[model samples]
Target: MLDIAKTAQLTPDLLRSFLVAADTGSFTRTASLVHKTQAAVSMQMKKLEEDLQCLLFKRDGRGVSLTAEGEILYRYSAKILELHDEALTAVSGPKLHGKVRLGAPDDYAMKHLPGILREFSVNHPQVQVDVFCDDTPNLSKMLDNGQLDLVIATDNVKTKFSAPLELTWILPERMDPSGLKELPLALFHPVCCYRENGLKALEKASRKYRIAYGSPSLAGLLAAVQGGLAIAVVTKDTTAKGCRHALPSDGLPPIKSVYIDLRFKPRNRSEVVSVLGGFIAKGLGIVI
Candidate 1:
């Protein structure tokens, strides 16, 4: 049996060193970052290997690469560091005092996010929130530029890192598709998940459809649909408020909603992001 006491005694500093080594692909560079001698870094790594009884790295031509065990340990180390950072920030701050610029796509912003934000605001009364309603691609760009701290957007473009949610189709109420060959549709602008999914579904089924109306805002799309223009596809949670599902009858395709986060920058504001993200996840019943 493994020594429970020894496992419990593993330190965060050692984990941090392990991650730094994995990231830089060199014990020397990792030692420089951690202000330790190269020999000391190598010793720590050897000690870690002994404790775990696994080879964490293998020396290549001139550098080192992670073994399979090393790769797994790196992933866990990153999560540990992330959680540690969040905990430190939560206790270090005066209730997140800052203007947190947040952005969301119009559909979700209107339908689902309000309740989550409401609960967040009640909990952190000191935070000043500035929200922008826009398309997913634009919102993602803003997040990359640090113009916004958090964003809730549909999965249109692929990010190196992201959290995804499943999406569904919504159609007109009590509509029959007995003789329908094509669908008259309302869609959001480009790079929106609903728009992409709708188009893909039609193409995959070889169905012909026309853009009856296109809108940048959810309100505009809903207005056009309600005015007897066409049907729109949206997240299940967003559409459950008013619209009904239309698939299997019209042969429309099904889609999923994906939530993505820009992890390019490691900021001191991650705790706030995590708290708000948790609210969103719980509200949507998905872990993105």
Candidate 2:
């Protein structure tokens, strides 16, 4: 016989955590994405499995993987969560009126957010969104100062990183990384994650480097790289039209990709923030 009582107790929060863990394939990452502790995530998974009466995950040193039952749950959780979110948004009314302050890098603001925001606006025409486009560091500072409600920024901290975008080296397809006296780099402010990581890696490798082009605008960085002015460090998710693979065949030391993260400030006490967070996760199908 089925334990209908146990099954009935499954909550949306647990389902959301499970979804995040499934998407990231790591409990630690799942916690970061859901704003929970690692222990809390583990306990939630344990409780969820107990309720369903099945082992849902397999854990090893590499990370966690789903059991066959887990695969089934993952599929259903996505659909169930989507429906749940839809119900909430529906009840909340399409004429949801509120102002949402959002910040993101120029590249993402240009390429990625438009479709998501357009869809959001279509659903909630009364909601107003003011977006700021700038480098991650500056945007992060604004978020900290409570001038922004939500921010998507490049993150160097592995623990706090959550965004799915891959940060990589974007250089001219024709340029070579070898035999240069000082590696020329087109980058954002030194406070930026990509610039910081790239420089640290190069210095640790004892390679000479120079900032060949510096700009706060992604357009400037793309222009410099496309014109063959210099090699730039940028997110691969925002891969410009004229660029080659990162450090292709140059035998340079491997550079790690910086994590892009969505962060909410403590002062952002708005129900719309929660609603939009759900929208970004469900509507855009991002783990966030």
**Which candidate leads the pack in lDDT?**
2
For model 1, give the 10-residue run with minimal summed lDDT: 235-244
Candidate 1 global lDDT: 0.68
Candidate 2 residue-wise lDDT, 172-221, digit = tens: 76878787778888988877777787888888989898888899878898
Clashes of each: 5, 0
Off by over 4 Å in 1: 1-94, 156-164, 240-242, 256-264, 268-274, 285-288
Once superposed on the true structure, which residue ranges of model 2 sit more than 4 Å away at CA? 1-93, 159-161, 282-288
Give the top-scoring candidate (TM-score): 2
lDDT of 1 by residue, 80-162 (tens): 86676566557765466556677877766655555466456546656677888887678868888889887765565555445
